[model samples]
Target: MSRTFFTSDHHFGHKNIIDFESRPFSGVEEMNAAMIESWNSVVAKEDKVFHLGDFSFLNRDKTRAIVERLHGYKVLILGNHDRGRSRGWWLDAGFDEVSEHPIVYQGFFFLSHEPMYMNKHMPYVNVHGHIHGQKYEGKSYFNVSVEHWEYKPVPFEQIRDSVAADEEQ
Candidate 1:
């Protein structure tokens, strides 16, 4: 059966991101290859992946090539950096869908590239990316930045369980 996954802030082909995020890879090439392998390790071709944003900093051709190689029906929610390109540009780059704004998913989850405002009193949980290694406090927010997930996509069930556990507390 196909599964759903979430991830963001890949910054692929952005050499400076290695130092900025304190990523372990020696270079952009290594980081890109390792992330590709890690993504494919858990995501099958039939799976669906929601990429929160900042997918890449490479040129169109390079970015498209990387996106084409990943395993999933890809969806991209525009991030701060991603605004440099148009939605149609992202579509041509291989994403199956593109959203310029945060979207409500599964009724209660708010999906966005940047974390949305949330509180315990609120019914919706924010699932987002963009801060990289940093995270907001509270169970109402879930950060799926690649740095937080060991450079791989996280299954939606994992996010669901985390929220459920937090709600119990």
Candidate 2:
């Protein structure tokens, strides 16, 4: 069996993620390296990772190079920033799928980004990125940005109860 992990919004080559967040990272290269390190630290050969969205910046080759270094089978849930050739490049990088709707794995919903409003009709609690908790308050969501400029995977057990409850509705 494979252990599944969820995370989003790495923005690997985006220098602004550090400046806007007031992170200690000095440059985009450092930030990207940190993300790769953080990911590889937790990821193992038998693990599966779901990257919700905004995996990289404007450069497809940069994104592909980073994705190639990370461990696990990556599944790309395409985000707003992921467009055009970037999508295809991501597939080539070894992502299992790229889509708009939620990708259910182990009975939980895996979505690239979150919605502005709540979805009462849906049965599953959305696991997303897009809006970090620092920007949006009281959403009961998790952020993947760890240690200023890192990407960490969050397990389903950490937030499964709430998600499962929502799915039952």
By TM-score, the best candidate is: 1
lDDT for each residue of candidate 2 in 1-169, tens digit (9 for 90 to 100)? 6777878877777888787766668898887787788788888977988877777774656666777788998887777777544556778765766765556555635354654344545444456777643433333344443432245787656557544553466
In model 2, the worst 10-residue window by lDDT is: 133-142
Worst 10 residues of 1 by lDDT: 114-123
After best superposition, candidate 1 residue 53: deviation in angstroms? 0.2
Candidate 2 global CA lDDT score: 0.66
Model 1 over residues 1-42: C-alpha lDDT tens digits? 999999999999999999998999999999999999999999
* Per-model TM-score on C-alpha atoms: 0.98, 0.78
TM-score of 2: 0.78
